[model samples]
Target: MEAEYDVAVVGAGPAGATAALVLARSGFRVALIESTRYERSRPGETLPPPARMLLARLGVWDAFSTLGSLPSHGNRSIWGGPEIAESSFIFHPYGEGWHVDRQRFDAMLASTAADAGAEVLYGMSVVDCSAPDADRWHIGLRGESGEAGTMAARAIVDATGRTARIARRLGATRQLADHLVGAAVHYAGPLREDGFTLVEAASSGWWYSAPVPPDRLVVMFMSDADIHRSLRLTEGDRWEHLLAEAPHTMERVEGCRPIAQPAFFAAVSHRLRRNGARGCWLACGDAAIGVDPLSSSGIVRAIRTGEGAGQAIGNWLLGRTDVAGAYERILDAEFEEYMAERSGYYALETRWPHSTFWNRRRTIDAAMRQQP
Candidate 1:
């Protein structure tokens, strides 16, 4: 017989892990499925300071804090102007932010979920999900050793990052504003700028460089997918040529040797038409709304949405109603606020009015304005 769960949360990142942890704590049998085993590299390692309270609320704060994550004091950027600028996190109630080891951070979340009583299935791929009726979701799974299994759940939460794999399988279409990609390269050297992150803009795109931990920094170029392909960033000379366009960024990366081949990440700024409320399922994290890296809200947002979904789903499973309504209202408000701020920020980069990258940003804003 197939295993059954009150909720089967897919993609055990921040959102899924939190969802599982919460559900398990609420006395529900939850199954958390994750494809990656967190053995390799992934991006989006930075988290704002406010996330501490969220982790604390979820009861995983002490474990996460003990991971020796690098503390980030603030950010120094040349964004919106030629001269460099600084924004300190000290103003926030929470002291310093963190640039975490993303792989380990994710592992910690998964481990915590398992300890909390959720069946944390790592290195497992969810092949598909079917809703035979209002009663349950039948999920197909494949194990790491090429073994196959099936599980049933009363509810599903798609926290699969921007992929929205499970939600899309159920007919949800992603709404996109622009095509964005991040090409990153890890660098190892002396900690040149200890506590502050760096952002510098160029004619084609922007650059983000931040110290991760111990003795390493990760620098990445942000641009549209087509633009990145056009520039042939895979080639060292071409990558360095565009990188040098930002003199300030060049200075930060100085003396740092590239420790890995350039890595690419999908940074597309987007959201879904309506987050999953169909057949007792909800989408969280980037699966629900994918914002740009410029906001630096990805991890925090993921954890927040996970908590909200967990609570809302818990309420519904226990005989409460309109969980989806509350979930939708909260996420919609966040999306609107983020879009407004994004528009204002992009408008500040008028220096690159003729640049293809800037043009795309403007076009996206103009389209949003035309929306009814």
Candidate 2:
């Protein structure tokens, strides 16, 4: 007979793994489902000081601490002005920020959850999911090798990132923002001892670069999809031309050659109409709220929501009726605060007031005032 877990968390990314970790540690039977095994390279390598505290509380910081991630002092940015300004993490209680190997770092989180007693199904894709009864769900699974099976769970946690695939299947909708894309390129150069991320603004878009593990740099250009296409930023000289506009980034890449051609994809931000339902099932992390990467708080947001949801689900299943309502209220407040902060950050770059991206962003705060 297939074992019916107390909670089945889909997508073993930071959120799902953290949820599974928290639930398992609390003595709940959890099945951590993941489609990919975290083998490919991923962006968003910078971890700010506040995130470190969350990781420590989640009990996964030790695994990350041993990885020898680059110690990031702070950030130097050219946003809102021509002059560069440097902010220091030295002020934060956490002291230093660490740039890490995203792929390896994420895998370690999954491993930690497994070690904590969650049954992690690596490389297993959830093909289908359905509520078998009022209190349980029937989950269809398929392995990478093509084998298939079924499992059951008392509750489900959708940590599948932006798409909220599982939650959508269960009757949720999404609210999308303007088309946004981020083009990335990895560069290598002489070893630098100081660790500080760099950010610069341009009329068409904004640029951000940070150091990751193993002495390497990751540079990304974020802009609207229409602007990127219209400006032809992908072409050979044009791509380099934009980088040159950002002095700090351009200087560091003096002798460095591109590891590969620039790659761009949808960085669209969205949020679910309802984060989770009244039942024990819940949607947390990006699956619940997808934010713009400019915030550099995705990892922390994922961990926070995942851990919060795990406890909420545990209590709700154990017969607490008010936990579900409280959970929604908490997420609602957080989302409102996030939108306010997001608007303030985007407004900092008014250098291109007439630009489509900037104009839309400036008015975004008004548009976001209404909740769906």
Candidate 3:
């Protein structure tokens, strides 16, 4: 007989773990599956105020806050025209944010799910999933030992980030925008300890810098994928050389060493037409909708979406159909907000370059926009 669970969350990142934690604590049998075992993951160590509020409500903020992470006062932008004025979020009353330790943060989220009675399984990749019935799901997973296993669940949630494995297999077509590509690297020490967002204007694209830990920062240049591809293919070391041009980033990391290899990805804004629910499956996080990386709202959106999915699944399990409709509405609202915010930001940048990366982003259509 195949093992069964009330909820099976795929991809133990922020979204999956949050859903598992919420459901498990509410007395639902939950299985949190992850492909990569967490060991110092890099991306998304910063949490804005909205996300911090969610963490607090979930009862895990204390654990994350005490982990030597710095609070982010606000974000900074250096786009527009000739002169740049730096503004801090402290101008607002609440004044909240965080620069996190991703390794510890992700592990804690997963551990909390397990502590709340969820079965946390690392190194388990979901290879396939299907609807067993109108309200039941069956999923196939490949274990680290090269073994295949199956599990039956009332609902399946996909939090697979950009990969969108389940969405693709389910025949969900996506609309991808090719305006931005990202390349990032982490550095150690002598950098700004207080968290801040730094932006710089460049001919090819724009550069972003953020403090990750006490003395380390993550710096990435985002623009057209062709720009990065050409740099890596033709100029080779040109990417690293360009980092030296960012005023704020270069000053802090004058003599720092990289903790990990520079990673690059073609950033795009896309979303599935339907986030499942034909039977007993749903998708969350990047699997459902993805926006431009420049917004830094992906992690927050993931947690929020997962929470809604968990709630909907809980209601459906109790034979409540109305709850699922509400969940779909929430998804639409959230995605639209994300798209608008990113579109506005890109619009601000477009005034600088006539037909460069900024122009493409500024002229984006309504479909390209998503809410947070």
Clash totals for all models, in order?
0, 0, 11
* C-alpha positional error of residue 195 in candidate 3 after TM-score superposition, expressed in Å: 2.5
Candidates arranged by lDDT, highest first = 1, 2, 3
Best by lDDT: 1
Task: Return the lDDT, model 1, position 303.
Answer: 86
The C-alpha TM-scores of every prediction are: 0.97, 0.94, 0.90
Model 2 Cα shift for residue 218 (angstroms):
0.1
For TM-score, candidate 1 versus 3, the one ahead is: 1
lDDT of 1 by residue, 309-333 (tens): 8888888887777878888788878
Per-residue lDDT of 1-372 in model 2, one digit per residue for the tens? 987899999998888889999999999999999988887787788888888789888877778888878888998889998999999998888888878898888789889999999999989988888875678889999999999989999999999887799888888877766567889888877745368888888877888888878888888999988788876865768888888778877887778777887888667677677635444678898888887888778888888999988899889779996886788688777877878887888887878878887888866667767645
Q: Candidate 1 at residue 75, lDDT?
A: 85
RMSD of each: 1.4, 1.9, 2.8
- Using alpha carbons, what is the TM-score of model 2? 0.94
**How close to the true structure is residue 222 of candidate 2, measured as C-alpha lDDT?**
92
lDDT, candidate 2, at 195: 88
